[model samples]
Target: MRVAFVSLETVSHRDTETNQRFQTVLEILAARGHDVHCYCATFWDDERATLERDGITYHGIATGLEARRSFLIRLPFVLAASSPDIVHVHAQPPAAVLAASWGATLARAPLVTEWYGDGGIDDNRWTRLAANRGARILTPSELVATWIRERGADGDRVETIPNPVDLERVRDVPPGERVDVIYARRLDEGANLESLLLALAELRDRDWQTTIIGDGPERAMYERLASDLRIDDRISFAGDCSLEERIAAYRGAHVFAQTAEHCVFPTEMLWALASGCVGIVEYHVDSSAHELVEGWDRGFRTTSEAELADAILAAGDLEHRTFDDRFADYDRSAIAEAYLEQYRTLEEAYGLL
Candidate 1:
């Protein structure tokens, strides 16, 4: 099958979650002998205008003052030239939606819009119209699928497909001695790291240490908060880390703590689980962290600071479990097959099979 993916940026220049997810799916489909072509922004001058890597073809579009104008003008022609069986657009930068829709229509191919549930859409008229234009809407979680449906997309057109993880890459590493309680998310306002700091402060007398991973705009603010809370000495900030470093952090952690107000199936949390860390989520009305750890022996959900501290302490007592069947569904291969099934279904429905 010939597939065309439209996105604002490619993983070559940016390593965001959305880009990673799309690249994973593209690579898997390409491995299966499907022709996958990605049309994305040329984020860097050094990046080639057109290149092929890992069986996937990438076409980098122009960027700058007239980026949108150039993209809109070129997209349709590009799609016509590719003549893809299906057009899959990563839905974000809402501006790109109309171009993708236009390109798909021009190519007379089924349009599948993939959304990451990143809180960019808010029932806006244009966003809704763009979403409704898709032949199918793919979201990373049920929460996101429901959001799209409420925003004027037909319920039947929306589907939930969780992001895939390379389970073996995260789980097969040499196990390190678990010690510190770890929090591995961007140190941004939305992360709600203050809550975790306050919770840890309450357990000052406890023997456990804290390791804060990842970096962002609010790193200095979080560092200040830790100092003000008088827990700075017991906490270490590891900054932004590579994938291998992340896996090592998860393996060496006694507890994986999350205090985010919202998350769409965090990849780090999944890695933590795969690495056998005890999972503890701070409950929030909109957060889905609880869903990942719920029903596991070492999984916990805390509603208050005291409860969070208690949960962290309790996690230290629990033993790390082996990588079992609970995470099989999240494996990259499994997720790839699921996406292929969706593509096949769409082909049959559109009479392309």
Candidate 2:
């Protein structure tokens, strides 16, 4: 099968979960003998050079003030030349959806758009129209699938396929000396790191250290908050780690805390869980973190600072646990097969099979 993937950027960035997911799927499809072509924006100097890797070809679209105009003008011609069987687009940047839709029509191929639960789409008519233009829409969680449906997408066309995790890379590492409590997320206003600091402050009597991973515009603010709360000494701000470093942090930690609100199936949380860290999420009205711990014994959903502190204090008891089968379905291989099934279905429906 010939597949064309459209996104704002390629996985060469490797900075976000969305890019990683696309990279994984491309590798999987390419390994399975599918001709995969990725069309994405070129932001950095290195991104301007086109190349082929892992049996997949990547074409970087132009970037600048006229990027949208350039992409819209060039994409249809490129798609027509490639003549792909299906065009799979990551739905964001709004312009990508519009351009990909047009390009897919020109190529006479099925269009499949994916929403990675970034909260960029709402009930706006234009957003709904772009989303509904796809022959199928894919989301990373049930919460996101529901959101798309409410925004006027057909329920039958929307499917939930969780982000794939590299299970072998994330699981069962030998723990370091200290039993660390870890919180990893963008240290921005929405991260709600302040709540985690307050909760940790409440447990001053407990003998546990925290390592906060990740960086954002509000990193300095979070650092000051930790100082003002007098817990700065107990916390370490290990900003933006490599994939290996992140897995090591998760494996070394005895407990992992999540305080972000409205997160849609955070891949970090999944990594921590798969690394055998005891999971605890501070409850929020719209938080999807609770879904990770819904029926798990080693996980907890705390409603208050005191409750969170208690959960942390109790995390030591869970140290004996190892990565289990709870998240087996999210393994990269399993997710790749799921995507292949979807692609085959679309091919059959389009009479390309």
Candidate 3:
């Protein structure tokens, strides 16, 4: 199978959630023996026409992000010549999807766009038109699927495909030093660490340790808040540890707290949950974190910080395990298979199979 990806800038340009997800998708296809090509602005040194790395061919569509308009103008002609089985685009700069629609038509291929709504895409007239252009729309969460549908994409065409995780890593990495509870997220305003902090403050009388695993612009403030609460000694400020380090902490902890006020997809929480932590998510209108724990027996969904505190305490009763198969459906291979199914269905629908 040959897939042509349309994105003016990729992870090489910047490591954003949107860019990273698309990169993972492209690599997954390449690793599985599918011929993959990405049309993007040149990020490597020199003005190379194409660069091949790791079984994926990247055709430079423009010089840099500044040439995005030119990228749009030249995409259709370039893609038409490539004649790929499918045209997969990153739906960020809205106009890119509109331009890719033209490319998909010229190539006589199915147009698929992956939209990560947490990137602050607006629902203006142009984006609305762009949304309707894709043969299929993929989102990281149903919360984002709702956003895409509202932006003019057909509800039937919007599919909720989550960010994939490596379950093997979860099961293999040994657990970090034991802690009673764990909370991980960038220590920014949206982190809502206070929800957990205040709850912890309320339970100062109890004997439990917490490992807060992230660092950001607001780390100092979160640390200050922890200090002011006088529970700083029991809390470990493990500023921005690596993936293996995070998984280890999650494995060691008995409960994982998801208190962020906004999230398109709770990647960290998912990782922690897969590491066998009992998930406790606080419900927020803008965040779909609670969506992950709604019906799960080993998880709790709360509406307030007080309730979140109670859930953490209640989680102590659950049997502790270092690893969990709770989220096997979200593994990378599983998600790749999901995409392969979409590819097959779309190809058959277009009679290209």
Candidate 4:
């Protein structure tokens, strides 16, 4: 089937959880023999050039304030040229999704979208309308799916597809001493990484190293917090490590932990499981991290700093049955097949066959 994916800017554009999942799904669909092409923004300098990596063809749409406009302007022409069976656009920003919906309508193809943002509909007034207009809506967690339904999307129109992990690529690295605990997230205001830093400080007496990955506006404040706690020496801000480095870090780590209270998807935790690290995540009402923890027994949830530390310590010694079974469900190949079936369903529904 021919599929067109419209993503404004994903983890592929930035090294964050959502983008990682975006790249993973796109790659998965492409590998499954679908004519998958991604329309994303050139958010960074390197993104200016177009390259086809993994199994997908990527076209860097455009950048800057005019990105949305440019995407809408060129998308119609691109769709005319490709004439895909289905167009699956991602992200929750109303204008973007709205434009994609219009494009799908003009192209005479089914439009579907995926959302993993807190502002699923509440982010802006247009969001809820655009989502409701789409043929289908996908949420990475049941929490997000419920949020979509509350915003007026029909329950049947929304599907819960958890984050996917490429289990094969995550081979256990040459066994290394398990002493490092890793936290990787965008240094964005919403990340709430400070809580995790404080939690780490509380566990200072324990023989463990803390590594912070990724960069964003919150870097300075987080660095100051580490210094203030006198845990600066123990914490290393390994800013923006490559995909390979991240996998290696997970492979060598004893635990992968985070303090992000809200999640559309937990990319870091997926990689953690793939690397065989015990998962430690914060507990919050809005998060899908619990799905990762509950779905895979390799993780534990805690609401307090003390509990988080205790959970991490306990996770290191516990054996999880859920890991083998649940992990299989989220594996890359299985995820690819699921997406292929979804595409087929869309094709049949639209009578595009």
Clashing pairs in 2: none
Query: What is the lDDT for 246 in model 1?
Result: 79
Worst 10 residues of 2 by lDDT: 171-180
Poorest 10 consecutive residues of model 1 by lDDT? Answer: 60-69
Candidate 2 TM-score, C-alpha based: 0.87
Candidate 3 stretches with Cα past 4 Å from truth are none
Candidate 2: tens digits of C-alpha lDDT, residues 1-353? 89999876666654666666667778878877888988876645664446677798878666732476787678777877789998998776656787888999889899998887564356676677776768889988777777778777888899888777778766645544355589999877789888789999997777778999999999999999889888898899999987778777787778889999868777889888887788999987556678788888899999888898888878777654446567888888888888888888988998888
Off by over 4 Å in 4: 7-23, 38-82, 91-108, 118-123, 191-194, 200-207, 214-237, 319-326, 351-353
- Arranged by lDDT with the best first, the candidates are 3, 1, 2, 4
lDDT scores for all predictions? 0.80, 0.80, 0.89, 0.74
Candidate 2 residues lying further than 4 Å off, grouped into runs, are 11-17, 42-50, 60-65, 171-173, 285-287
Order of candidate numbers by TM-score, starting with the best:
3, 1, 2, 4
> TM-score, each model?
0.89, 0.87, 0.98, 0.78
Better of 2 and 3 by TM-score: 3
Candidate 1 lDDT over residue span 232-290, tens digit each: 99899989988788777788887888888988766788888777788889887666678
lDDT of 3 by residue, 90-110 (tens): 987889998899989999999
Choose the strongest candidate by lDDT: 3
Q: Which 10 successive residues of model 3 have the least lDDT summed?
A: 117-126
